[model samples]
Target: MYGAETWRTTTTTIKKVQIFINSCLRKILNIHWPDTISNSLLWERTNQLPAEEGIRKRRWKWIGYTFRKSSNCIARQALTWNPEGKR
Candidate 1:
């Protein structure tokens, strides 16, 4: 059995560790994407280019979550549209 003093020290150490871990997790989840210096001028440059080239340049990459949700939505729609098992 731990003495009273030892029990108090151990509890304090555990609380400190928990606080440090919670702070780290908050920092990791709140990460922001940095903007480039030319980001502000992108609109002007795109406007001067041809329509097809401008559209290509304006395309943004999708994250994994976006793709997963899109696929799930498509599957649900397909199932709803196809009542029979033909699909």
Candidate 2:
């Protein structure tokens, strides 16, 4: 999930990332083979947000940080810029 906040995520993409996260967490918790746990419980134990929610939060965090920058900043301008013509 490195640089995931910058990704243009789709449902498939988010699902894949979520699956990976869950598997990793399960391994870290030693919840292997015959053992099982619900995703909600896993998240609770790990104190983790769902992949989509986490990514959205990171994206918005970046946006807010950029917005607080000086007006001349390129990232802030990219977010706030309006085109005068249709693409």
Candidate 3:
């Protein structure tokens, strides 16, 4: 009787479980296509163009948590956080 009850529960839940697992696997294996525009000479010309006033004035915030410490140490850590200079 116990085995029969467990079998019934598992059969009822199997479809829902399979759907959830497939959805998760789909996202995990998702692919991103490369930008064709960025591959062209137009992309190079755009990059070489001077920054507009608004673009130049825009300030990027440093992301990541700050602990209670000396300002100098925090500043140094922020600088070293992304040596590749990614925003």
Candidate 4:
């Protein structure tokens, strides 16, 4: 539950949120869910890419290249924001 207020109840909610986010991203990118082996290989490849290449390069090379710039910005903001409103 990772420090959630109610461990047992929150776990299910967390899983559902994760699944929903994953599905949304997949649909937005028009990509299939990766198999276990492919997923591992993808992480390995991502690590090999240069950090200086920036988000656009990585997003295009790995994630769906078709994502609009503004959508990516909004997604990044949503992911990085804390629920408590603290930086």
Those runs of model 2 whose alpha carbons end farther than 4 Å from true positions after fitting are: none
Write model 3 residue lDDT over 1-87, tens digit each, in one string: 112212323444645644444444434445224432332233244343212211222312122323344556855476457556567
* Candidates in descending TM-score order: 2, 4, 1, 3
For model 1, residues 1-87, the per-residue Cα lDDT tens digits are 122222323456655644454444445445334633232234343343323332333332222323456545864355346466675
Tell me the lDDT of model 3 at 48.
Answer: 35
lDDT of 4: 0.44
Q: Give a tens-digit lDDT track for model 4, residues 16-67.
A: 6545544544455456746323433443544532222233354455334223
TM-scores of the candidates are 0.25, 0.89, 0.25, 0.29
Poorest 10 consecutive residues of model 2 by lDDT?
Answer: 1-10
> Which candidate's lDDT is highest?
2
Q: Tell me how far the alpha carbon of residue 54 in candidate 4 is from the true structure, in angstroms, after superposition.
A: 22
TM-score of 3: 0.25
Give model 2 RMSD, 1 decimal: 1.3
Instruction: Please give the CA lDDT of all the candidate structures.
Output: 0.39, 0.92, 0.37, 0.44
lDDT, candidate 2, 1-87, per-residue tens: 677768999999999999999999999999997999999999999999999999999999888888899999998898899889888
Instruction: Itemize residue pairs with steric clashes in candidate 1.
Output: none
